[model samples]
Target: MKFVQPIRDKRKIEAMKKVLKSESVRDYALFVLGINSGLRISDLLALSVDDVTTETGNIKERITLKENKTGKTKDFPIGTSAHKALKEYLDTSSLETTSPLFLSRKGTKAIRREQAYRILNNAARTVGIKDKIGTHTLRKTFAYHAYKSGYDLSMIQKLLNHSAPSVTLRYIGITQEEMDDVYLTLNL
Candidate 1:
Protein backbone atom coordinates (compact mmCIF):
# COMPACT_ATOMS: atom_id res chain seq x y z
CA MET A 1 0.00 0.00 0.00
CA LYS A 2 1.05 3.58 -0.60
CA PHE A 3 2.07 5.83 2.30
CA VAL A 4 -0.20 8.45 3.82
CA GLN A 5 0.91 11.50 5.78
CA PRO A 6 -0.54 12.92 8.94
CA ILE A 7 -2.52 16.14 8.96
CA ARG A 8 0.39 18.12 10.39
CA ASP A 9 -0.77 21.68 9.86
CA LYS A 10 -2.68 23.08 12.81
CA ARG A 11 -4.69 25.46 10.67
CA LYS A 12 -5.67 22.68 8.32
CA ILE A 13 -6.76 20.58 11.26
CA GLU A 14 -8.98 23.36 12.55
CA ALA A 15 -10.46 23.82 9.12
CA MET A 16 -11.15 20.11 8.88
CA LYS A 17 -12.92 20.25 12.24
CA LYS A 18 -15.05 23.14 11.08
CA VAL A 19 -16.11 21.30 7.93
CA LEU A 20 -16.96 18.05 9.68
CA LYS A 21 -18.72 19.78 12.54
CA SER A 22 -20.92 21.72 10.15
CA GLU A 23 -21.79 18.62 8.16
CA SER A 24 -22.67 15.95 10.70
CA VAL A 25 -22.30 15.30 14.41
CA ARG A 26 -21.32 11.69 13.77
CA ASP A 27 -18.61 12.74 11.39
CA TYR A 28 -17.35 15.40 13.79
CA ALA A 29 -17.23 12.98 16.71
CA LEU A 30 -15.48 10.38 14.57
CA PHE A 31 -12.73 12.79 13.58
CA VAL A 32 -12.38 14.14 17.11
CA LEU A 33 -12.17 10.66 18.62
CA GLY A 34 -9.74 9.44 15.97
CA ILE A 35 -7.29 12.28 16.57
CA ASN A 36 -7.60 12.22 20.35
CA SER A 37 -7.64 8.47 20.98
CA GLY A 38 -5.24 7.24 18.29
CA LEU A 39 -7.35 4.24 17.41
CA ARG A 40 -7.21 2.57 14.01
CA ILE A 41 -10.01 3.35 11.60
CA SER A 42 -11.32 -0.18 11.91
CA ASP A 43 -11.41 0.06 15.66
CA LEU A 44 -13.00 3.47 15.51
CA LEU A 45 -15.68 2.32 13.09
CA ALA A 46 -16.35 -0.82 15.11
CA LEU A 47 -17.31 1.20 18.16
CA SER A 48 -20.86 0.84 19.44
CA VAL A 49 -22.87 3.44 21.27
CA ASP A 50 -22.27 1.58 24.52
CA ASP A 51 -18.53 1.86 23.99
CA VAL A 52 -18.61 5.64 24.42
CA THR A 53 -21.89 6.38 26.17
CA THR A 54 -23.32 5.47 29.50
CA GLU A 55 -26.89 4.36 30.14
CA THR A 56 -27.76 7.94 31.03
CA GLY A 57 -26.34 9.20 27.69
CA ASN A 58 -23.18 10.83 29.05
CA ILE A 59 -19.87 10.31 27.28
CA LYS A 60 -17.63 7.96 29.22
CA GLU A 61 -14.28 9.10 30.49
CA ARG A 62 -12.63 5.95 29.20
CA ILE A 63 -13.30 3.78 26.13
CA THR A 64 -12.33 0.14 26.02
CA LEU A 65 -12.00 -2.04 22.95
CA LYS A 66 -10.29 -5.16 21.71
CA GLU A 67 -8.31 -4.41 18.61
CA ASN A 68 -9.47 -6.39 15.58
CA LYS A 69 -6.00 -6.80 14.18
CA THR A 70 -3.98 -7.20 17.35
CA GLY A 71 -6.62 -8.78 19.57
CA LYS A 72 -5.27 -6.71 22.44
CA THR A 73 -7.53 -4.96 24.88
CA LYS A 74 -7.05 -1.22 24.85
CA ASP A 75 -8.46 1.47 27.06
CA PHE A 76 -7.92 5.19 26.79
CA PRO A 77 -9.44 8.30 28.21
CA ILE A 78 -11.60 10.55 26.04
CA GLY A 79 -10.22 14.05 25.95
CA THR A 80 -12.39 17.12 26.48
CA SER A 81 -12.74 17.92 22.78
CA ALA A 82 -13.65 14.36 21.82
CA HIS A 83 -15.90 14.07 24.85
CA LYS A 84 -17.82 17.21 23.96
CA ALA A 85 -18.35 16.06 20.41
CA LEU A 86 -19.41 12.61 21.55
CA LYS A 87 -21.86 14.09 23.99
CA GLU A 88 -23.32 16.26 21.31
CA TYR A 89 -23.70 13.25 19.00
CA LEU A 90 -25.29 11.10 21.64
CA ASP A 91 -27.69 13.83 22.68
CA THR A 92 -28.75 14.53 19.13
CA SER A 93 -29.24 10.96 17.95
CA SER A 94 -31.57 8.27 19.22
CA LEU A 95 -29.02 5.50 19.15
CA GLU A 96 -29.52 2.33 21.08
CA THR A 97 -26.87 0.94 23.36
CA THR A 98 -25.89 -1.77 20.91
CA SER A 99 -26.17 0.38 17.81
CA PRO A 100 -23.05 1.08 15.87
CA LEU A 101 -21.51 4.42 16.79
CA PHE A 102 -21.03 5.24 13.10
CA LEU A 103 -23.76 3.96 10.90
CA SER A 104 -23.71 3.54 7.16
CA ARG A 105 -25.98 5.47 4.82
CA LYS A 106 -28.52 2.66 5.09
CA GLY A 107 -28.29 2.92 8.90
CA THR A 108 -28.23 -0.84 9.23
CA LYS A 109 -24.54 -1.48 9.73
CA ALA A 110 -21.35 0.12 10.95
CA ILE A 111 -19.64 2.33 8.41
CA ARG A 112 -17.00 0.57 6.37
CA ARG A 113 -13.33 1.49 6.45
CA GLU A 114 -13.66 2.85 2.90
CA GLN A 115 -16.52 5.06 3.99
CA ALA A 116 -14.48 6.37 6.93
CA TYR A 117 -11.67 7.16 4.53
CA ARG A 118 -14.05 9.06 2.28
CA ILE A 119 -15.39 11.09 5.18
CA LEU A 120 -11.91 12.09 6.36
CA ASN A 121 -10.51 12.56 2.87
CA ASN A 122 -13.35 14.82 1.81
CA ALA A 123 -12.88 16.93 4.91
CA ALA A 124 -9.14 17.15 4.33
CA ARG A 125 -9.64 18.26 0.74
CA THR A 126 -12.22 20.83 1.79
CA VAL A 127 -9.63 22.30 4.17
CA GLY A 128 -6.95 22.45 1.45
CA ILE A 129 -4.74 19.79 2.97
CA LYS A 130 -2.35 18.69 0.24
CA ASP A 131 -0.98 15.65 2.01
CA LYS A 132 -1.90 12.11 1.06
CA ILE A 133 -4.61 11.58 3.63
CA GLY A 134 -6.62 8.48 4.38
CA THR A 135 -8.09 6.65 7.35
CA HIS A 136 -4.60 5.94 8.65
CA THR A 137 -3.93 9.68 8.69
CA LEU A 138 -6.00 10.04 11.83
CA ARG A 139 -3.86 7.61 13.79
CA LYS A 140 -0.69 9.17 12.42
CA THR A 141 -1.91 12.67 13.21
CA PHE A 142 -2.50 11.63 16.82
CA ALA A 143 1.02 10.28 17.05
CA TYR A 144 2.51 13.31 15.30
CA HIS A 145 0.93 15.84 17.66
CA ALA A 146 1.60 13.68 20.69
CA TYR A 147 5.30 13.47 19.87
CA LYS A 148 5.44 17.16 18.99
CA SER A 149 3.99 17.94 22.45
CA GLY A 150 6.98 16.23 24.10
CA TYR A 151 5.54 12.87 25.00
CA ASP A 152 8.19 10.21 25.48
CA LEU A 153 9.02 8.22 22.37
CA SER A 154 8.81 4.89 24.17
CA MET A 155 5.52 5.89 25.70
CA ILE A 156 4.07 6.83 22.37
CA GLN A 157 5.45 3.68 20.81
CA LYS A 158 3.73 1.54 23.36
CA LEU A 159 0.53 3.52 23.03
CA LEU A 160 0.52 3.00 19.29
CA ASN A 161 1.43 -0.67 19.74
CA HIS A 162 4.52 -0.10 17.67
CA SER A 163 7.43 -2.45 18.22
CA ALA A 164 10.00 0.30 18.71
CA PRO A 165 10.57 4.04 19.09
CA SER A 166 12.45 4.14 15.80
CA VAL A 167 9.40 2.77 14.05
CA THR A 168 7.19 5.32 15.77
CA LEU A 169 9.52 8.16 14.80
CA ARG A 170 9.61 7.09 11.17
CA TYR A 171 5.89 6.41 11.14
CA ILE A 172 5.14 9.91 12.41
CA GLY A 173 7.50 11.48 9.87
CA ILE A 174 10.05 13.20 12.14
CA THR A 175 11.65 15.76 9.89
CA GLN A 176 15.32 16.19 9.12
CA GLU A 177 15.19 19.72 10.50
CA GLU A 178 13.84 18.50 13.83
CA MET A 179 16.43 15.74 13.99
CA ASP A 180 19.21 18.18 13.17
CA ASP A 181 17.96 20.50 15.89
CA VAL A 182 18.14 17.65 18.41
CA TYR A 183 21.76 17.04 17.43
CA LEU A 184 22.64 20.76 17.46
CA THR A 185 20.98 21.48 20.82
CA LEU A 186 22.43 18.66 22.87
CA ASN A 187 25.87 19.52 24.26
CA LEU A 188 28.48 17.25 25.77
Candidate 2:
Protein backbone atom coordinates (compact mmCIF):
# COMPACT_ATOMS: atom_id res chain seq x y z
CA MET A 1 0.00 0.00 0.00
CA LYS A 2 1.21 3.50 -0.85
CA PHE A 3 1.27 5.36 2.42
CA VAL A 4 -0.18 8.84 1.97
CA GLN A 5 1.46 11.26 4.35
CA PRO A 6 -0.92 13.33 6.41
CA ILE A 7 -0.34 16.90 7.48
CA ARG A 8 0.31 17.09 11.20
CA ASP A 9 -0.82 20.32 12.76
CA LYS A 10 -1.80 21.35 16.26
CA ARG A 11 -5.21 22.26 14.97
CA LYS A 12 -5.56 18.92 13.24
CA ILE A 13 -4.70 17.05 16.43
CA GLU A 14 -7.12 19.14 18.39
CA ALA A 15 -9.87 18.51 15.89
CA MET A 16 -9.33 14.80 16.21
CA LYS A 17 -9.43 15.09 19.96
CA LYS A 18 -12.67 17.01 19.83
CA VAL A 19 -14.29 14.22 17.90
CA LEU A 20 -12.73 11.38 19.84
CA LYS A 21 -13.28 12.94 23.23
CA SER A 22 -16.85 13.64 22.26
CA GLU A 23 -17.45 9.95 21.82
CA SER A 24 -16.65 6.99 23.99
CA VAL A 25 -13.67 7.22 26.31
CA ARG A 26 -12.34 4.18 24.51
CA ASP A 27 -12.04 6.13 21.29
CA TYR A 28 -10.13 8.91 22.99
CA ALA A 29 -7.78 6.33 24.44
CA LEU A 30 -7.25 4.83 21.00
CA PHE A 31 -6.33 8.20 19.50
CA VAL A 32 -3.96 9.17 22.30
CA LEU A 33 -2.20 5.80 22.33
CA GLY A 34 -1.54 5.94 18.60
CA ILE A 35 -0.17 9.49 18.61
CA ASN A 36 2.03 8.70 21.57
CA SER A 37 3.18 5.11 20.98
CA GLY A 38 4.20 5.48 17.34
CA LEU A 39 2.68 2.05 16.86
CA ARG A 40 1.20 1.08 13.56
CA ILE A 41 -2.57 1.35 13.73
CA SER A 42 -2.71 -2.41 13.50
CA ASP A 43 -0.61 -2.76 16.63
CA LEU A 44 -2.66 -0.18 18.40
CA LEU A 45 -5.88 -1.88 17.39
CA ALA A 46 -4.47 -5.16 18.60
CA LEU A 47 -3.51 -3.85 22.00
CA SER A 48 -5.02 -5.30 25.14
CA VAL A 49 -5.08 -3.80 28.61
CA ASP A 50 -2.24 -6.07 29.62
CA ASP A 51 -0.14 -4.60 26.84
CA VAL A 52 -0.04 -1.27 28.60
CA THR A 53 -1.82 -0.54 31.86
CA THR A 54 -1.11 -3.05 34.59
CA GLU A 55 -2.13 -4.05 38.08
CA THR A 56 0.99 -2.46 39.52
CA GLY A 57 -0.54 0.82 38.34
CA ASN A 58 2.43 1.92 36.22
CA ILE A 59 2.68 0.81 32.62
CA LYS A 60 4.26 -2.55 31.90
CA GLU A 61 7.61 -2.79 30.17
CA ARG A 62 7.82 -1.56 26.59
CA ILE A 63 5.17 -2.86 24.24
CA THR A 64 6.49 -5.81 22.28
CA LEU A 65 4.97 -6.92 19.01
CA LYS A 66 5.79 -8.55 15.72
CA GLU A 67 4.65 -6.00 13.18
CA ASN A 68 2.33 -7.59 10.65
CA LYS A 69 3.95 -5.94 7.65
CA THR A 70 7.61 -6.45 8.52
CA GLY A 71 7.25 -9.53 10.69
CA LYS A 72 9.88 -8.06 12.99
CA THR A 73 9.65 -7.70 16.74
CA LYS A 74 9.23 -4.09 17.84
CA ASP A 75 9.21 -2.61 21.28
CA PHE A 76 8.58 0.96 22.43
CA PRO A 77 8.38 2.33 25.92
CA ILE A 78 5.03 3.84 26.68
CA GLY A 79 5.26 7.61 26.86
CA THR A 80 3.63 9.75 29.48
CA SER A 81 0.78 10.81 27.26
CA ALA A 82 -0.06 7.27 26.21
CA HIS A 83 0.16 6.10 29.80
CA LYS A 84 -2.26 8.74 31.00
CA ALA A 85 -4.68 8.07 28.20
CA LEU A 86 -4.73 4.37 28.90
CA LYS A 87 -5.20 4.91 32.58
CA GLU A 88 -8.14 7.20 32.01
CA TYR A 89 -9.74 4.77 29.64
CA LEU A 90 -9.21 1.91 32.03
CA ASP A 91 -10.67 3.82 34.90
CA THR A 92 -13.69 4.94 32.94
CA SER A 93 -14.51 1.55 31.51
CA SER A 94 -13.09 -0.61 34.30
CA LEU A 95 -11.47 -2.77 31.67
CA GLU A 96 -9.74 -5.92 32.79
CA THR A 97 -6.13 -6.65 31.93
CA THR A 98 -7.11 -8.99 29.13
CA SER A 99 -9.87 -6.95 27.45
CA PRO A 100 -9.29 -5.27 24.13
CA LEU A 101 -7.71 -1.88 24.52
CA PHE A 102 -10.45 -0.22 22.54
CA LEU A 103 -14.03 -1.05 21.68
CA SER A 104 -16.97 0.13 19.63
CA ARG A 105 -19.73 2.19 21.18
CA LYS A 106 -21.56 -1.06 21.69
CA GLY A 107 -18.41 -2.55 23.29
CA THR A 108 -17.66 -4.76 20.31
CA LYS A 109 -14.28 -4.83 18.55
CA ALA A 110 -12.70 -1.40 18.44
CA ILE A 111 -12.39 -0.77 14.68
CA ARG A 112 -10.36 -1.49 11.61
CA ARG A 113 -8.60 0.83 9.13
CA GLU A 114 -11.81 1.59 7.24
CA GLN A 115 -13.74 2.54 10.34
CA ALA A 116 -10.72 4.28 11.87
CA TYR A 117 -10.35 6.47 8.79
CA ARG A 118 -14.00 7.45 8.92
CA ILE A 119 -13.86 8.26 12.61
CA LEU A 120 -10.79 10.43 12.16
CA ASN A 121 -12.16 12.09 9.01
CA ASN A 122 -15.35 13.12 10.70
CA ALA A 123 -13.22 14.76 13.36
CA ALA A 124 -10.96 16.41 10.79
CA ARG A 125 -13.93 17.90 8.98
CA THR A 126 -15.25 19.40 12.16
CA VAL A 127 -11.81 20.88 12.86
CA GLY A 128 -11.71 22.44 9.32
CA ILE A 129 -8.59 20.82 7.85
CA LYS A 130 -9.52 19.92 4.30
CA ASP A 131 -6.32 17.95 3.92
CA LYS A 132 -6.45 14.18 3.75
CA ILE A 133 -6.08 12.26 7.01
CA GLY A 134 -5.97 8.53 7.39
CA THR A 135 -5.35 5.77 9.90
CA HIS A 136 -1.64 6.26 9.31
CA THR A 137 -1.87 9.90 10.33
CA LEU A 138 -1.71 9.21 14.03
CA ARG A 139 1.33 7.00 13.63
CA LYS A 140 2.95 9.61 11.45
CA THR A 141 2.11 12.25 14.00
CA PHE A 142 4.16 10.28 16.52
CA ALA A 143 7.14 10.26 14.17
CA TYR A 144 6.74 13.91 13.17
CA HIS A 145 6.53 15.15 16.70
CA ALA A 146 9.40 12.95 17.73
CA TYR A 147 11.52 14.38 14.94
CA LYS A 148 10.59 17.92 15.87
CA SER A 149 11.56 17.13 19.44
CA GLY A 150 15.11 16.30 18.34
CA TYR A 151 15.16 12.54 18.47
CA ASP A 152 17.92 11.31 16.15
CA LEU A 153 16.69 10.10 12.79
CA SER A 154 18.52 6.84 13.27
CA MET A 155 16.97 6.38 16.70
CA ILE A 156 13.57 7.16 15.29
CA GLN A 157 14.25 4.62 12.59
CA LYS A 158 15.02 2.02 15.22
CA LEU A 159 11.91 2.91 17.16
CA LEU A 160 9.75 2.48 14.11
CA ASN A 161 11.65 -0.71 13.27
CA HIS A 162 12.38 0.82 9.88
CA SER A 163 15.34 -0.50 7.99
CA ALA A 164 17.04 2.83 7.27
CA PRO A 165 17.48 6.42 8.38
CA SER A 166 16.68 7.77 4.92
CA VAL A 167 13.31 6.06 4.88
CA THR A 168 12.61 7.34 8.38
CA LEU A 169 13.43 10.92 7.39
CA ARG A 170 11.20 10.75 4.36
CA TYR A 171 8.39 9.18 6.34
CA ILE A 172 8.67 12.06 8.80
CA GLY A 173 8.36 14.44 5.79
CA ILE A 174 11.68 16.27 5.94
CA THR A 175 12.34 17.57 2.45
CA GLN A 176 14.96 19.07 0.18
CA GLU A 177 13.44 22.44 0.81
CA GLU A 178 14.27 22.26 4.50
CA MET A 179 17.65 20.74 3.78
CA ASP A 180 18.51 23.46 1.29
CA ASP A 181 17.44 26.16 3.71
CA VAL A 182 19.73 24.65 6.32
CA TYR A 183 22.65 24.48 3.89
CA LEU A 184 22.19 28.08 2.75
CA THR A 185 21.76 29.44 6.27
CA LEU A 186 24.80 27.71 7.78
CA ASN A 187 27.31 30.36 8.92
CA LEU A 188 30.10 27.92 9.69
Best by TM-score: 1
TM-score (C-alpha, index-matched) for candidate 2: 0.86
Q: Write the per-residue lDDT of candidate 2 for residues 1-188, one digit (tens) a residue.
A: 65656556877786677678887667777888888878788878887777775577557757887887788887778777777777777777766677777765556575667877777777777788776677887888889888888888887888887889888888878879988998899979
lDDT of 1 by residue, 1-188 (tens): 56999888888988999999899889998999999999999899999999998878788889999999899999989999999989888888888899999877686799898888889989998988888999999999999999999899999999999998889999999988989998899986
The C-alpha TM-scores of every prediction are 0.95, 0.86
- Superposed by TM-score, candidate 1 places the C-alpha of residue 121 at a distance from the truth, in angstroms, of 1.0
> After superposing candidate 2, which stretches have Cα over 4 Å from the reference?
56-61
The 0-to-1 C-alpha lDDT of every candidate, in the order given, reads: 0.90, 0.77
Clashes of 2: 0
Model 2, global lDDT: 0.77
CA lDDT for candidate 1: 0.90
**Candidate 1 regions off by >4 Å?**
184-188
Q: Give the 10-residue window scoring lowest on summed lDDT in candidate 2.
A: 103-112
Count of steric clashes across candidates, in order = 0, 0
